[model samples]
Target: MVVNVSNLSPRLRQLGLVAVLFGAIPAGLALMGGGYPFQVGITALIFVTLAVSLNLVTGTAGLLSLGHAGFFGVGAYAAALAATKLHWPFLLTLPLAGIVAAALGVIVALPTMRLISIYFAVATLGVGEMIHVSLLNWVSFTRGPMGIRSIPPIEILGLDLSGVIGGYYVAATVAALAIFAVHRLTHSYYGNALRSLREDDQCSAAMGLNPVRLKIEAFAVSCAIAGMAGAVYAHTASFISPDSFRFEESILILAMIVVGGLGSLPGAVIGAVLLIVLPEVLRGIGDFRMIAVGVFMFLSILFLPKGLLGEASAIGLARRQLGAAWRGDIGAGWK
Candidate 1:
């Protein structure tokens, strides 16, 4: 009577996961009467997208960036400005936000590419602070600390999706697509090149891989995806402030990947969901909710040093689920 999920083929497993994400979970939330739960769901989905994007650069490419939230804020502000000032629609604003963030990412990458280890990390930290300060001080442009207000919600062709249920679906769809894209990129030879860079840039360069170019591309792509998540946040929340995307936010995101196990796509998603949902679930604990979260994080680090799902296990699972496609059983090469 019990189905063995592990025995399912890669395609089947993927379909089941999609069903759970896009179908069962939403249906359950709907049964619970939506409301605040939907808000949490949307927030979790947004963080999921952010975590996956961060995983690409920090986990896969081995670049410890501390300014991810700055890029996220850039995306939100870009989308907000485009929507409020330019009167652009959601469709246009989404891509615009991503493009703007990606452009900034490239600029940051160019100067910081040569820096490595903690030096690069500090550089990103400074850049993130600069972004926060700029947003706080640019009163004329970003409306200073007042933040953007009355931003339109997700509406495609006049269908208003600002309601709880509708917004959850929109967020879920975006998160799903982001996961799919990251999964594809990470499982391919391209991902292999990134891992090479992570292992040793010098050796990778000697192997003819352009470490600088690859890192830049990875960073740009990661930022672009983070920007898209920001667009979703802006539209869904209908408001945003510089305070929302500060250094703490970036650290929270970094913690998600670290807790989930770096270099693992599945781990990133799991970590995002856990960090977002666990605190909410512990809300009954009054002021100690965050303390509980800290304890859980500490225990996780102590017992599960490699993470709840380590990279090695995650890769093995991926290979098993992917089956022929992963092993090139058909001789079509690594697809």
Candidate 2:
């Protein structure tokens, strides 16, 4: 079942909107007060943006990329270089990072167009490793292992956003914008084309949709959004290195999309918040923290096979309810 907001009942639509608006309150409060909690909020917003961007390819286009961190790193480096070397303003660097990352996405997409499923995934993993090595080896450009330092914080229109409060606001605003953009994209005809490609590329192509073009476009858009998030992260933290955007980071992001519910927008946000906050919440566990995390994920997969927000199981429940209604099963609660 394709779950479009327009297809939902008016009451459900209003409820969803209310829930979305209310969800912003906690983050806003955290930002209003600066502290460790505020810091965590900033990081959560960044991950939220990344998760949404990754969903474009992984969820909508059904492309499992294991190297999204490569594009993310590219964006961070691009922003850093522009700020440190070219002395560009923060505003300019944001788009520059996205453009550079999108270019890399195109490069990656071209070679992997003929591949799909596991083959495509493996190729992306290799691409991520290549980026990591390049960042480590390209000393003069990326400053090698020492990473970029003293990177200036975001400033716009005579306002400096280096403070925790300002940083959180910026991160939240960017994340909100990213979510809105994805929502618009996913509701359009183009989104349907991507979904069709995900369901069956050959069949979509037979119906006159161009799978290759759609896939490449999705990848470019997704990576570009990731790059924007990276730029925000670099400016907010005022430091970035290749280690920050490694294979493990990619895996964590993949986990966010999966645990949140693949192909669900709200799922991206939920997954980002849950996973990013989960580690912090588990800090008391000390040596066994990761074990707990692994066990939790195992159980989630075992139970919510399609993910927490995935439609497959929801559709099943809906069908059961309708069937019960047809048979006059009053206890089923269907009027």
lDDT of 2 at 70: 85
Candidate 1 root-mean-square deviation in Å: 1.6
Cα TM-score per model: 0.97, 0.85
Q: Which stretches of candidate 1 lie over 4 Å from their true place?
A: 329-335
Q: Write the per-residue lDDT of candidate 1 for residues 106-211, one digit (tens) a residue.
A: 9999999999978999999999899999999999999999999999888888988879788888888889999888887888788889999999999999999999
Q: What is the C-alpha RMSD of each candidate to the true structure, in Å?
A: 1.6, 7.1
Error of 1 at 256 (Å): 0.5
Top candidate on lDDT is: 1
Indicate the TM-score of model 1.
0.97
Global lDDT of each candidate: 0.91, 0.83
Model 2 regions lying over 4 Å from their true place: 1-33, 312-335
